[model samples]
Target: MGKYDPLGGYLRRLKTDSVDLGFAEIERILGAMLPKSAQRPQWWANQIDPQGRHVQTRAWREAGYDAFPEAGAERVRFVRRQV
Candidate 1:
């Protein structure tokens, strides 16, 4: 959740359906995973290629990477939304 300091607050707002309309998609995806007590939240990691093309991390997104249950003790938790 680096550079995502506001993400936790944003997620809290989103879970209660208090998010602005611009965050609709994010809300929907997280909401769909509500049944799982422990979820691997998805992340949008940006990468710049040698050609300067910005690419979002599709693999992590698809895998629903978990920032919680953690890879290890040094891991960081991500924002959670009810969306």
Candidate 2:
């Protein structure tokens, strides 16, 4: 399984249009620590690199969600992407 596959699985199970979770909570779901890059907003952007380096993006996007980090907060709000 991919490192972020568990996160994808988690998001796929949610029924809400949006879900908010702390960094710690996400770490728990990931069973791994997020990279320091996670502190930046761009890390949560929906775009991905050509090398597919941003596995986390594949996770949420495939699950039909997008992550929005609350500035100055340790939490992120994942909104279901509009189809």
Candidate 3:
């Protein structure tokens, strides 16, 4: 499993349609520090690379959520995607 799979499972199990989490909270769930690129909003975008390199994005997307990073708040809001 990929490192971010843990996060996917966590999100998938949530009953709420939305969750707001700090970066530190995510690291706690991941047990690994996010990359420096994570500071950029683009890093949390719901897009993917052609080679499937964006594993983190895949994690949330697979869990039926979309991540939206707060501007300069060091937080992210995950909204469950509509079917």
Off by over 4 Å in 2: none
Against the true structure, whose TM-score is highest? 3
lDDT per residue (tens digit) for residues 1-83 in model 1: 32222333344443332332223333354443222322332322333245633222322222333223233222333332222
**Model 3 reaches what TM-score against the true structure?**
0.95
Off by over 4 Å in 3: none
| Highest lDDT against the true fold, candidate | 3
Descending-TM-score candidate ranking: 3, 2, 1
Model 1 ranges off by over 4 Å:
13-15, 21-83
Prediction 2 TM-score vs. true: 0.93
Backbone clash tally (model 2)? 0
Across 3-56, the per-residue lDDT of candidate 2 in tens digits comes to 889988999999999999999999999999999899998889888666998878
List model 3 lDDT by residue over 1-83, tens digit each.
89999899999999999999999999999999999889999999898677887879999999999999999988999999999
lDDT of each: 0.32, 0.91, 0.94
TM-scores vs. true structure, each candidate: 0.19, 0.93, 0.95
Report clashes for each candidate as comma-separated counts.
3, 0, 0
